[model samples]
Target: MDTSRARRGSDFARLSRRVAEAGLLERRPGYYAIRIGLVGALFAGSWAVFAAVGDSWWQLPVAVLLAVAFAQVTLLAHDLAHGQICRSRRTARTAGLLVGNLAVGLSYGWWMDKHTRHHANPNHEEHDPDVAPDILLWSRGQAETARGLPRLIGRHQAWLFFPLLTLEGVNLKVSSFRALRRPSLKNRAAEALLLVGHVVAYLGALFAVLPPAKALAVLVVHQACYGVYLGCTFAPNHKGMPVLTAQDELDFLRRQVLTSRNVSGGRLLDVALGGLNHQIEHHLFPGMPSVNLRRAKPIVRDYCRSLGVDYVECGLLASWGQALRHLHDVGQPLRAARRA
Candidate 1:
């Protein structure tokens, strides 16, 4: 194999150009239109079901379903943030802010900046704050030395912390402040409004109903559903993959492509996960409009093989197992800084 085809991080400018020429960096408007419409329908449908339940015996299930729908909407919000959900950057940003803040209860500004950084410096100990917040630094010593519940939970399941984050107020606070600190005054204001709306909606639901217990039950059920949906959909991408170094951009893209597995079983995974099942292709050609990811994988795989890199493909069960094994092997916590 001609390993030289793989670019090193030192050749980022050239590599970026190649990625463009390969047609992996463009977005398809039609796909995004469908995505927006479908997710919107799911959200509307979930809410309708909830409303129809009307504090009846099925109210809990309905609330939980609504939360799941809300979490799925976050996937669309992510695509919008990547500018894959729309043609215009402004439109994408607007949609991202709206969906992320209102639907998923996250700060759009914060998520945009943070996720952008993740792409820019994936796995960099110094740059990827999402790498590992509280885990012990494996490079420093044995993985056994890591501290706290974050360490104990392990990487594969660490995503479970996402739901707990909602209650801890970390997601809302850190993301909100981060957005406020940036140049996006509009995003900050939008997020503020969404946050207030979420609170008011929840509180209103609680007060509108007769008993406080019923309201608490609704909140718990809803958040739990959101947590499960959010964690599974987002956690598998990088948790088990190697961290990309400053010198590894070329290799990183290739590795990201090779290491990132795709889970293709049915339409639910495809639509609900927003083509993330083809994550390797998606990461390698981020701007290529994810709708084409499934089709692009073979081309990407051939190209990767030409470069002598490995391509990993698996179903959800197998992928999940690999994720767990990777976490078990690398018991050390992720580094929390960007590389120089």
Candidate 2:
């Protein structure tokens, strides 16, 4: 047993006990049952209506609605991936594969690996894949070395954020297929098959029902909206929170709290964001059911205050503003160099 690991997670362990005592960590079977049924019904219902509406421009609006359904199903898959609703690892993996790959055309294995790293190190520049300076620079160090398209885009990334998100849906699918090349991916063959199956079924339906041109247009709209809606759901989580480096040594509790921020909103925003507005709690307790995060917020906040740690939470728009400001500021150096 690694005593060092135990020591590092001690604070988190105590906090976990408190949360457990409050029953926050317990799975909400009733909540998840209804939630899953409703999302599944909505997903099936949307597709049925799309088929019923057949061969018309009116289907464009239906495409948008289906995008919402897609995002929601993806969110549910996220919950399953975290074992939020599943008790056994086997069950979680099976469910994740079905929900993510078969239904949504996303690779469960690929997303699981990426998301695990993120939860393990939320804003760490080196360890967290989420902050790894892909197209947009997350830190000045990355920005300095960025070139070509990334450099061009990083300079105005804040303004381009939403527009860029329109491409993320395509990017995600492409990335999933690409991840299959890696030997580290588990059950790669199954993941690949399910994803390909999703493509065949999805495209087949589009072309079968509508004219070729209209089919292409509807496909574009669905994917674009899916990307935008998915991006919008996640953008506010930790974009402006503190970025950590190797030197910033901290225990699990502080690590999770300091690097995360919460968005305060009404029930509508809460559901839309899929309980991600309570990102702080979600990070600290990854397996905690989404519905319980809100209830755990105050408890965690007061605990943080006692420990002299800052708990960040703000209104929805403010959170986005802070994130955009960070993106703009990171690009300031490049803009300055451009001017000179």
Candidate 2 lDDT by residue in tens digits, 204-303 = 9999999999998998899999999988778888898898999998888989999898999887887898899999999998899999999999889998
With candidate 1 superimposed using the best TM-score fit, by how many Å does residue 61's alpha carbon deviate from the native?
1.2
- The most accurate candidate by TM-score is 2
TM-score of each: 0.79, 0.96
Write the residue-wise lDDT of candidate 1 on 1-340 in tens digits: 5555543553335545655776767767676777678778989897677666666656788777777687778777777777675678887777776677766667777777777776766556557766644642322232445556645554433344444534433344355655665675565677778866766775675557526777678777777667666656655665566655456545565555644666765676777677888877777767667667777777767766765667777777676666655555554343321121
The lDDT values for all models are 0.64, 0.91
Model 2 TM-score (2 dp)? 0.96
- The per-residue C-alpha lDDT of model 2 at residue 79 equals 95
Q: What is the C-alpha RMSD of each candidate to the true structure, in Å?
A: 5.8, 2.4
Query: Model 2, which residues run further than 4 Å from truth?
Result: 1-9
